[model samples]
Target chain A: MQSDNPTAAILVIGDEILSGRTREGNAHHLAQVLNATGFDLREIRVVSDDQDQIVAAVRALDGSLGGAFDLLFTSGGIGPTHDDITADAVAAAHGTTVVVDAGARALLQARCDRMGLELTPNRLRMARIPVGATLIDNAVSAAPGFSIGQTHVMAGVPEVFRGMVDWLIPKLPGGRPVQSLSVEVRRGESDVAEPLAELAREFSDLSLGSYPFHDERGWGTNLVVRGLDAARVAEAMHAVKQRLAL
Target chain B: MQSDNPTAAILVIGDEILSGRTREGNAHHLAQVLNATGFDLREIRVVSDDQDQIVAAVRALDGSLGGAFDLLFTSGGIGPTHDDITADAVAAAHGTTVVVDAGARALLQARCDRMGLELTPNRLRMARIPVGATLIDNAVSAAPGFSIGQTHVMAGVPEVFRGMVDWLIPKLPGGRPVQSLSVEVRRGESDVAEPLAELAREFSDLSLGSYPFHDERGWGTNLVVRGLDAARVAEAMHAVKQRLAL
Candidate 1:
C-alpha cells in the first residue's frame, strides 16, 4: 500500500531489550535512515519477545497507521532460539507457516558447513521464512532478515541489523532522494527563525532544520535545508545564510 | 502507581534526530533501559524540532491507552534556542508557564559563564522548568533534565540522557527488585521449551527467557531466570541449568 505521507513504523522486541540487560538500539538508526530517505516515521513500539505480542504489533502497524505508512520495520527476534518466534508470528498474522525457504536455507547451511558445525534441526530454524517473502541479506552474519511485503525483518544485534537496513532501504522503489546543506551561524535558532521560516516558505520543497552545538568557540546553531532537488537546497541555504549574515 | 506489568513511553525531539544527518539514537537506548527496569515500553516517538508536534506527542503519551503507562520520558528540546521546545510542551501539557527555576537558572548561568558564553536570554531558556518539578541531575552535562510527578524529562545526548535515567530510576520508590541468572546451553529454544516450561512452572515467580546466539561453535541459547527475589532467581537458574545438563 502507498500513501502521500510516505510514512514508516518500527516494532522492536526481546526481553533483553526491555530489561536493561542488553542496551539494544537500532530503531534510532532506522528512523534516521528512513527520515533521510524521506519516509515519515509515525510509530515505534517495543514489545517483549513473545510470539503473540509480535504478531499483534505487526497487525496493528499494518492496520490503519500502517496503511498510512509506506513501510513497516521489525527489529530483533529473527535469530534461531526458543524465544525467537518472530518469523512464526509474522507467518501467523498472515496465516502462513514458518517454513525453510530454499535460498535462505541453502545459504545458512553452506555457512554452517564452512565452520564445520553440524546443522541441528533448531539451527535450521534460522532458515525459516514467512511464505513468499524476499530475504534481506545480512552480510555481517549468515542468518538473513527477510522482507515479506512491506515489513522488513532484521536481527537484534545493532551492527548486523544496521547492515540489513542499509541493504533494504536503497533497494526499495520509493524515497524523496534526500538533499541537505548546513552553515555554522553564530546565533541561537531564535535569532534566525523569522528569516529562516521565510526561506523555508520560499523553498516549499525543502525541509529546513536548525541544531545547536557547543564547540570551543561557543554555542552556535547549524541551519540546514533539505529537499529532493540539490540546486533548490543550495539556493535556500544561501538565502538563509545571507539573511543571518553569517 | 506500581503494578506487576509496568509500562513506560518516550518522546524524542530534535530535527537533527529526525534527519538522517545526525545518527540520533538516545531514544532507542532509553526504551531498552525502561524495559530492563521492567516497564512495558509501549511507545517510542521522535518528533521533528517542531514545537506543536512535541507538545502533541507529549500530551498524547501522557493521556494515551487510558494513561496506561506510569511514566513518559521526553529527551531533547530543552536547549537555549527557539527550536528547543520540550520544556514548553511539558509546561503546556500541565497548562503552566515554563518559568526559569531560580536554582536552575543560577546553575545554568554558572556553567555558561564558566564556559565564557554571554548567557544570552535565549541561553537561559534551558533553565525553564514546568512549575513544581524536581530537576534530574546531569553528571555528563550540567543542564539538568527534570521529573514532574511521573513524567521524567531528559536530554537528547546519549551520555547525558543515560546518566539522567540512572539518577531518576534509583530515586523513584523501589519497585520489585529485579534479579537474573543465565547459562548458555548449546541448543535452540524450541528444543528446550518443554523442559524449560516445566522449570518455569516450578519457579512460578521467575520470568524465564531464552536468547539464541550464533557463535563460531554453533547455535547456543542463553537461558535466563528473572524474578524479584534473588533466591528464586538462583533456584530457577539452577533447575534450568540442570535440565540442560550444563
Candidate 2:
C-alpha cells in the first residue's frame, strides 16, 4: 500500500530521563534509523514511570499514526526496578495484563544463570508482556523488549535499547526511505537567511535548514537539505551553496 | 516557598528531532540539571510542529504540576520557520493570542540586528509571545526563550537549550540538596549484586546502583549511592563497599 503519509513517534518512559539523571541519545539514534528506513519522525516524548502517564502517551502517539505510521518506538522503564513500569503500561494501554510469556521467561532464565543472580519475585516482572506481543531479543542484557500492534517497546539503557531497535526495525515493513544532504559554511544563519528561504520554497519537496555554528571564524552555517529523493537533495544543496556564494 | 512535592516536566518541540534529523540531548541534560537541583522530574515529552500536539502537551503538563513542580522546562520550536508553531500553541493553551510583547520585541530586534538579519514579517514571528510571559535570554543565540506560568520554553539546540535551562532553573527555589558517592571495583554487576541490593534495602532514604564498566580485570562496577542527605549517602557507600569486600 503506497500511503501518502508515513510517520513514526518515540515514547521514552522513565523518571531518570524526565529528571535529567540520564542524558538521552537514543531519540537521535532512532531518528536516524527511522529516517533511513522511511518514516516521518512525527513526535517524541519522555514520560515518567507513572502507569497513567505512560498509557496516555502511548495511546496518544498510537492514535496520531492514523494507520500510516509504520511503527511507534518506546524506550526505557522495562527493567526490574520499581520505577520501571513501561511493560505494565504497554499492556494496560492495549487492554491486557502483564503475563509471563514462555519465550521471555526462557531468555531471562538463561541470562540470570549466566550472571549467577537469583530470579526473584520482582525480577519476574521483566518477563511480563501484553497479549499477542512478539519478543525483541536483547543480546546485551537479560531483559527482552516487545512489539504489540505497531508499537515497539524496548529498554532504557542506551546500548541495549538501541541494539533492539536496530535489530527489529529491518524485519518490519518500511514505508519510505529517509534521505539527507549537508553543506557547512562560515556564515551566520541570518547572513544567508534570505536565500535559504527562497531555496526551501523552490525545493518545496525537500525540508531545508540553516544551522549556524561557531568555529573560530566568527560564525558559520550547516545547511542541510532533506527529502525522500537523493537527486532532489543534491540539487537543492548545490543551489543553496551557489545562491549563498559559499 | 518550599513545597512538599517538587514536581518538574520537560516539553521538547521540534520536527528535526522528531524526524530524527537532529539528536536530542537536551532532555537528558535537563534531567541531570533537575536532579542536581533537587526537583522531582515527573514527565518529559517531545512533540512535533503540529499545533494540536503542542497545545495538548502543554495543557496536560501544566495540569500535572498543580503548583507542586519546582518548574516545567521546554526546549525547541522557538524559531522563525513555517513549522515553528510553539508560540501560537502556547498562547492557545494559556487562552491568549500570539502577540508581540514589548520586552520580547526588544530582545528579538536586538538579536536580529546583532545577527545582521532584517526583521521581516517571517523573522518577527520568533518575537511572538504569549501575553504576560517573561523572556529567558539566550547568551549563545540571539533568539530569546520565554516562560509562561511554569513552562520554560527554550531553543532545541543542546548547547543553547542547556544554557537557557541552567539560567532559568537556579532562579527558582531548589527544594532538595542532591548527594552522590561512587566506588569502582574489579567486578561485574553480578559479582556484587546481592550485597548492593541488601544495602539498598538497608538505606530506605538512598538509591544504590551498580554500573558495570571497563576495568583492568575485564569488567568493573561503579557502585553509586544517591540520596538527599550527604551523611547517609557517605555512610551507606562505605558500608556497601566493605560488606562486598571490594
Candidate 1 lDDT tens digits, B7-65:
67777776675455665457567755554565656556666665676666676666432
Q: Which DockQ-derived CAPRI band holds candidate 1?
A: acceptable
Worst 10 residues of 2 chain B by lDDT: B63-72
Least accurate 10 contiguous residues by lDDT in model 1 chain A: A61-70
Per-chain TM-score, chain A, candidate 1:
0.81
10 residues in a row with least lDDT, candidate 2 chain A: A62-71
Give lDDT tens digits, candidate 2, residues B1-246: 122447777788866676666667777787787778777777777776678988877877775435324467777777665556788888787777878877767776887788676677766777788887888975676677888887788887666786787778778777785677788788645456666767777886776755544433565656777778888888998898789776
Which portions of model 2 miss their true places by more than 4 Å? A1-5, A63-70, A80-83, A108-125, B1-5, B64-70, B107-125, B183-202, B205-223, B242-245
Instruction: Give each model's whole-structure lDDT.
Output: 0.71, 0.73
Which residue pairs come into collision in candidate 1?
A: A18-B35, A18-B36, A19-B35, A19-B36, A20-B36, A82-B189, A82-B190, B6-B40
Per-prediction DockQ: 0.31, 0.43
RMSD of 1: 5.1
Model 2 TM-score relative to the real fold? 0.84
